[model samples]
Structures are given as C-alpha cells and as structure tokens.
Target: MSVKETAQEVLKKIGGSKNVESVTHCVTRLRFVLRDFSLPNKEEVASIDGVISVIEQGGQYQVVIGNKVSEVYDEVLKELDGSDPTDKIESKAHHKSLFDKFTAMISGIFMPVMGAMAGSGMIKGVLAILTITNLLSEESGTYIILYGLSNAFFYFMPVILGASAAKYFKMDIFVGAVLGAALIYPTFIPFASEGELSFLGISVNMMDYTSTVFPVIVAVWFASKVNMIAEKFMPKDLKFLLVPAIVLLISVPVTLIVIGPIITLLSNVLADAVNAIYNFSPALAGAVIGGPWILMVMFGLHWAFIPIFIANMASQGYDPMMGLLLANQFAMAGATIAVGIKTKNDKLKALSLSTGVTTLFGISEPALYGVLLPNKKPLIAAIIGGSFGGVIAGIANTVQYSFGGSGLLGIPLIINTSGIDNGFYGGIASQIVGFIVGFALTYTWGFKEKSTVDSDDYSGNNTLLNTKINVNDILSGEVVALSEVPDKVFSEGLMGQGLAVIPNDGKVYAPFDGVVTMIFPTKHAIGLTSSDGIELLIHVGVDTVELNGVGFKSFVASDQKISKGDLLLEIDLAVLKQSNFQIITPILITNPDKFSKVSHENNNLILAN
Candidate 1:
C-alpha cells in the first residue's frame, strides 16, 4: 500500500483522527497518547493495513510501523491540519506509578537522540578495537579522526540532550539546544577546569564540564519551559525569534552560574553511588545492568546509559556493563532467528526472517516489534537468556578494555591483555557460554504454541467430498459448490481444501478448529492454522492487504488449538466489498510444497463432512 494510504488507514482504525490525544515518532514507532485506551474496535484497529503491531506501554498506545515511522508520523500530522502531535492535555501528575513515570521520563528524553547516540557508541567501540589491536595509534592522524568522530557527540551532548529535553517539556527545542550549546562553549571550559573563583565576586567554581551529563539536560528542560512562557507573551509573528532570544538570555547565564555546577555535582553523586554498588557486588551489578536492558530497548531509554558506559571505559580502562549488554542483544537476536525458522505461516516467517537479519546488524526494532513482543514467549526467553549471560559475565569480572561493538561479533574487545590477569579469555568464555545457553533455552522453550490445534488433521484427508459440478455453473453466477472452482489445489486438495460456496451473505466461517493466524490489519485477508497442522490463507478480495485488515475479528490466536468448525474469525465482507476491496477469496495451502500430489477438481460440487 502507498505510505499515505497506510498512514490514513492506521489513523482511522485507532478511532479516527479525533481519538488521538497526541502523536510523536522516534526512530521506529509512532508513539500516540490517546484520550482512552479502550478505543472502539481495538482488534480491528490492530489489523489496520500498515501497522506492524499495537503496543500499550509506558502509558502510551504505540503503533509499531517499522523504520518509516517518522515519515508516517509526519504524514499523519499533515492530515491532522498541521497539528503538533505533542500538544496534548497534561496527564495527571501522579497518575502513573513511580517506576512507570521514571521509565517514561527517561524514555521521552533519550528516545529522540538514540540514533545519533548509537552511531557514536558504535564508532567508539570500533575505535577501541582498532587501538587495542594496534591497527591504530593514539598519536596517529587516523586515530584522531576516529576518536573525534566518537567524541564529538559526548563533547556536545548538551545540544542533543537539549533538543530531546525540549520535546519532553513541550517547549521550543531549538531554543533549548542553543542554551545547551552555550553550556559547552570552549571559552568557558578553561574557567570550568580551574579552581573555584569569584565571577564578579559571586564566587564561581571552574570545573571540567566536558562530557558531562544531567546538568545540560536539566538546564535545557528548564529553558524549554521558559521559552514556552516567553512565547505566550510575544506576538505570533515574532514569537519564534523572540522566545529563543529571551529564553537563552535568561537561561544560559543561570545554567552556567548556578544550574551547571549543581547538576554536575548530582551527576557525580549518582555515578559514585552506582560505582559503589558495582564495586560491592559485581554479580548484583550485572543483574541490575542487564535486567533492564530489554526494557530500555523497548522505550529507547538505553541511550541514557551510553554516557555512563563511556565514562567507565575512559576512567577505568574497562567497563563490565557493556559486555553484559552485548550478550543481552545477541541473545535476543539468536532467539528471534530461532523463532523465525520455527514459524509455519509464510507472512510471519518472512517478517521473522527479515527482523532477524536486521537485528544481527544492530538494528533490532524489526525483531522487537515483529516477533519478540507479540509472541511473549520469545521475549521472556530472551530476557532469561540475557540474565544468565549477564550474571556469568559479571561473575567472571568480564570487562571490555576497549569499547567494542555490543554484539556477538565484538567479543574480542572484552579481552584485557595488558590490564587484567586472565588474558580476557574468561570474559570471552562467559559471553560464549551465556549466548549458547540463552539460545538453547530460547530454542527449546521460547516458542509457545500460538495455536491450539492438532497439526495432522489439518493436513490429512477429511470427511468431505466433491460429488460433481461444472465450472461453467460457477462462471454463470450459479451458487455452485466450492469444489467446482476448477482449481485442483482447492477442489480436491489436502492442505487448504475447504468448501467455497458463493454465499448469499458476506460472512466467513472457520473450516475447522484453528486459530486465526493473521487477519490483515486492513481486514483484506485472513489466515488460519487448523489444529491439524494445516495452514490456510484466505484472501477475501484481490489486493486486500491494501485494506489493512479492517473489520475483521479473530476469536482465536496465532497458535491456538481448536475443534473442527470452530468460530475462528469474523469478517464483514460486505463492508470490505463496498470499500473498494476485491472479494476473490483464495484458500491456498501455505505449505503446499510439503506434500505430494495435492490435487483438486475445478468442476465438482464439494460437500463438507
């Protein structure tokens, strides 16, 4: 489907444009705040044409639409009359639980900057590897370039954090960014590095503010609020220019003179606390670090952890948290690949395979949205696997001497040849064992049967028959038996054999006990997997995936077992037909190649057993 149409369909399914309280997009999903979570036709909404999945987490209703989420979000905004998606009524201050609020706040601040953060993090990892291998020197020009590339983000993090914080605060982001940039101005760095002194007799402390965190974020957040207030007083024509000027004039000096030092001190305290805890109990530390890794990934909050990882590496010449995080990512990727291979549905298989590939390359949104979240089992399995691996790494005192990539391929970075006594092999062994165990556990226990049906009956001969009928009868618009459709694959077929009567009503019924495999969010197509291992794809109309699987309801689930003729799915085919959807229902064997001589008769009247 066209991207525009896809966006429109999603908007309609989620209770139309009016139901959306607010909308925003990060790297991979359209994050929506709705007036109510209980929207009409939620099942149907989920079946919408372009949606990957619907998730309710962090007090927001999220639609997973792959990497083009921002483009789709922009299109959605344009359709909403240039409305800013982030402008919503303030949620109750205390409505969310403490933990939820914390996660939400962290996620909102970091999500927007995640893409750049990951790029820089990966560069640093690569540079570390290069330096450790002696492929590059600390004094080399090449090393300088790579180091600069990695360091640039940290050195100017306030700018990025400011923009993100402004979004979170619902204020002028550009203004906030300018305020942040002022905090890191080169002229101030010299004074910041010096001892405490009086700035015009007010007494200011010169501290090393480079690569600092929290202070700039807090400053920008306050600046954004200040900008918002200034914007209200300024004329609309001058608001944009005046608001920033006013906010910066007031905010920058306050941040430099007051807020920066306070926040920097707080950051140090927090860092010290975390370090103390890690020093006291490294295994507990690993669990603490690894446990929330997936949760961090879910909301894109992991970016907040990057600065700490880098800080640890720089100061200690090693960081254990990153090694554990690497194992966690690899475990998830491995589990996803396993599930992709185990799934039977063609569409699901394709999604899983594609997601798996992307995950291996450090892009895990596809896997997270397409497979892990929906299946539940795989997600849990991955978490368990990650925890196990993390604990092992932690117990082994595994540390990455160099910042290496966070995945299976980056294992060599953990080897501390010059510093640690064990030659880094212990960390390597810990990661390998953790990954293997995690994969094995996931492969064995991660895939719960999404369908509750006998696999054999769906694939075996049934108590049905095609007596006799003419293909001309069907062509002549007669209510001929489905067996007369003239396709041997459907007429006398074993895999997807089902009666296809030109029903007087636009209703659909389950052919046997099965779970609804897929009801296209557009409601254009439906797939079912019978308990007897038969996978069925029934396209109600031509180009129905274009419909976004709207107006369809699945009483069953992906791996649910059912009895023969169970009520698996309900669809308003009449609505579909009226809405420009084709009704050429095709019930084909998704796994036809698995069996031999799968036959059907095009000119026969078939009777259900």
Candidate 2:
C-alpha cells in the first residue's frame, strides 16, 4: 500500500483522527495517544500492509513502521484536524505517569533536532581527526568554517532546544527562541563572569545557559502555562502583543534567576554521580550496563539514559557511557554472521547475513529482533561478548567525544582530541574482542538446528485425512475447565468448547502444529490447525485485546508452517497481573463438530481422537 493509504488505514483501525489526542514519531514508530484506549481492534491494525508490529508502551500506541515512519507521520498529519501539532495537544486530557511525561517530553524536544545534532557531532569528530593528523590547520579559514559548522549547534543548544520545546509545550516558537537568546545575549552573558547581577534592584543569579538541557524545557513549560492563563483572561485583540510581552518580562527573568542556576547545579550533580559510578568501578559499570544494553533497547527503556549522555557531553566535553556499550553492536553483528554461516536453512542464512551487514552500520534492531533473539542462544553469546569487551573498554577509560553511528564508521568519534591514546586503541580492541568472542561462541555451541516437520503432516485443505492427533499443552500452565472462565463468551461455550489454562510462563508453544492460520493483532490470541484436523484458538487472557499489544509478542506469522512445540508467542505476565484483566487463557477447539468425542485428558492435555 502507499504511505497515504497505510496512514489512513492505521488511523481507521485506531478509531480515526477523532480518537487521537496527539501523535508523534521516533526513529521507527508512530506514537499515538488516544481518547479511548479500547476503541481500536489491534488484530486488524497489525495485519495492515507496511506495519511491522504494534506496541503499546509508555502510554502511547506505537505503530512500528520501520524506515517509512517519518513519511507515514506526515501522511497521518495530513489526515488530522490541524496543521499545527499543538492543536492536538490541547486535547491531551489523558493522564500519564510522571516518568512517562518526562521521557515523552524529553524525546519530543530532542527528536526534531537529532538529525542535525548527530551530523554536527560527526563533523566535530571528523575535524578532530584532521587537526590531530595535521592535515588541516586550526588557524586556516577552512578549518574555522568547518569548526563553526560543527560547534554552532552545541554552542547555541539552548536556542535550538527552546524552539523545539515551544513546539512540545504549544507556545510561541519565536518567543521561546527569544527567551533562550536572552540568556546568552552578548551584553548579558558577560555578567555570568561577574557571578551576580542586579535586575530592577533585585539580586539575580547569572549562569551560562549555552549547551544546557533542562533549563529551556522548564522555562518553555512555565511560559506555556502562563500563555494558557493569559489566554483565559486577556483580550484576544491584545493577546498577540501583550501576552508575549508579559511572558517575556516574567519568564526571562525567572529563568535567569531561578531555573538556569538550579538546573545547572542539578546537571552538575548528575554528571558527577555518573562519574562517581564510573570511578567506583568502571569495569562493573561497563559490564552491568553493556551486558543488557540490547535488551534495554528492545524494551524501549534505553531512552532513560539519553539525558545522562547529553548532560555528560555538555558538561564534560566527552562521555564514556556510550563508549562502554559500543561493543554491543559488534557483538550482535558477530552473532548474526555466525548464525548465517552455521544455519542450513537457506532463508535463515540469507536473512542472517543481510541483517549482519546492517548491524555493522549501527542498526542492530534488524539483526537483534530478526536473527539473534529468535535463535535464543546467540543472543546470550552476544551479551557475553559485549560484557567482556565492555570491561576492557572501561579499564582503558575509552570516551566518546560526540554522538554518531555506533559501529565501524564511528571510530573517529572515540579518538581523543589530545592525540591517539589508550582510549582510542581500547575502543578498537574492544570491538575486536566482542566480534571474535561472539562469533567463536555462536559458531561453536550457541546454535543448534531444530528438527523440521514433514510436509505430509497435513492436507492442503487443513484437514487430517488418515492420521490421528494429540493436542499438547499450548503453554506450561494449570489446566481448568472452560466453564471456569470468568467471561461469558468463553465460559458459556459461545466461542467453542475446550479447557482454560492459568499460564505459569509467558511463552506459547504450538500443539500438534501444521500451520498458523491467524494471529490476533494484539498478539493475545492465536488460531491454529493441527495436522490431524483439530482447529484451536489459543487466547491468552480475558479482555487482553484492550491492552493493545503491550506485553504480548508473536513469533510466527500467519499461514506459516510450524512443528509442534515451536514458540508462537510470549506474554509479560507481570505487566498483565497489574491490570484488571484475568490471565486465564482459553484454548478452544473451534472446529469441535469435526469429531463426536473430544475428551479432556487428566494430565492437563487435550486429546482429539
């Protein structure tokens, strides 16, 4: 489908534009906040073309659309009520947790500028290399221009963040910029050297706001709140002039006196704490963080560390945090390549090799979710490899001078401005160790091929012609009668007759599998036809579809051929137990009429003979 069609279909599936309170996009997903959480059918949404998956996380319905997310976001905007994203922000009546709001706010502020920020960071890295090698003279006009291009963004970070923050806070963009500019205004910035300045005869604290993160966000939030109150009482005729004037007079001084210094202090504390962690035991810090870094990325939890990374860069001119985790990408690539080399399946080999290439470019998601994760053991190997390399890097005190790619292409970013040093060699050595260990371990024992099911297991029409079948447990859980289920639809045998299970583990396995007929969009349910003609519907929990694919993960695709005991899905029971929904999963024989006797076995197994 075209991008526009995909956008429209996604909108329709999510109860249309009217249901959306607001929408935003990160690198690969379209995030939406809905007025009614239970309005959309997740199964239908996931089945849409161009969508990779659906994830409900951090109070947003995230549609995974891969590289086309930005295009789809634009198309989505065209279908919304207004051109300004702030127009939709007015409808954010839904409540989000403090952490959720903070993360969302930070991401919103930074995402718009990330492209430029990364490019500028890369330029700085490149310049550092040229100057170190004596290929470029720092005093030359060319060097000066390049340095300005690279440094200007970080030098005036407050202004950039202010403009972005205004968009996030639904305030006047220029007003936000002016407030940011006022902090570093040529005449005023010198006062920071003076320590304190008098404003209207009142003592005002002075601090440089350049390259800061928190101050502008707090300032814009305060300004937005002020603008909101002003709009309530001020005449609309005078709002254009008087509202901005009032906001500037109040916000600029408040920010200069209170917000800037406080945030700067807090930022310093945070930076110091990070340094303390590293200083206490750099190896432990590196191993602890780097070992599970891929898992953190998988669950979208890595966003929590971004502020720390930014703060470290702004305050210390370089950060060791990213360098500690740099081995992860290499480890992932190594595992993928190992899988590619060892797998007998041509399709698996092809995918493993291709995704391995992507991992080298610092795009490890493709390899992670597609290759290593599904294989299980290779992921562990990668983790082990990454942790080992991380320890070495920590010992060497490798540092990342700027944000850029995390793979071979970003080697320059680890180069110290002083000259080639132990840190630079440590970074290169870490990647080497990560790759070799990951590859060696995976190739030696991390992967073992599974037995394949015979093609004659079932008929083309999904009916068992002559063979008998036994339906094993779809998951490891306590089996109970279907009538014991709380919901009327399943308790009353309206959907079909079968047993219900209280799962002890989150994984779902295939029972007498032939082909996967369907997977529910929310991934809470599955439809399967056994080789011997038993058609079963494995539903995870009661009313789980309302959760919108949050804790559920489907491994098999629709119509895929599979063997019995193959992993079909994984659910986070912990996340579900917190909700009101019951975790009783009903495994129903949807085509019960095909047999006269469908007996339930005593060993918690279903026998259709």
- How do all models score by TM-score? 0.65, 0.76
Off by over 4 Å in 2: 81-95, 458-469, 472-609
Model 2: ten consecutive residues of lowest lDDT: 450-459
Which runs in model 1 stand beyond 4 Å of their true positions? Answer: 15-27, 33-42, 67-102, 233-245, 287-292, 295-319, 340-354, 365-377, 400-405, 408-431, 445-609
Top lDDT prediction, candidate number: 2
**Residue-by-residue lDDT tens digits, candidate 1, 110-188:** 6666667667766766676676778778899998988898768767877878777877787777776777777777777
lDDT for position 586 in model 2: 87
lDDT of 1: 0.62
Best by TM-score: 2
lDDT assessment of candidate 2: 0.79
lDDT of 2 by residue, 513-537 (tens): 5999999889999999877777788
Q: Model 1, residue 256: what's the lDDT?
A: 73
Error of 2 at 465 (Å): 18
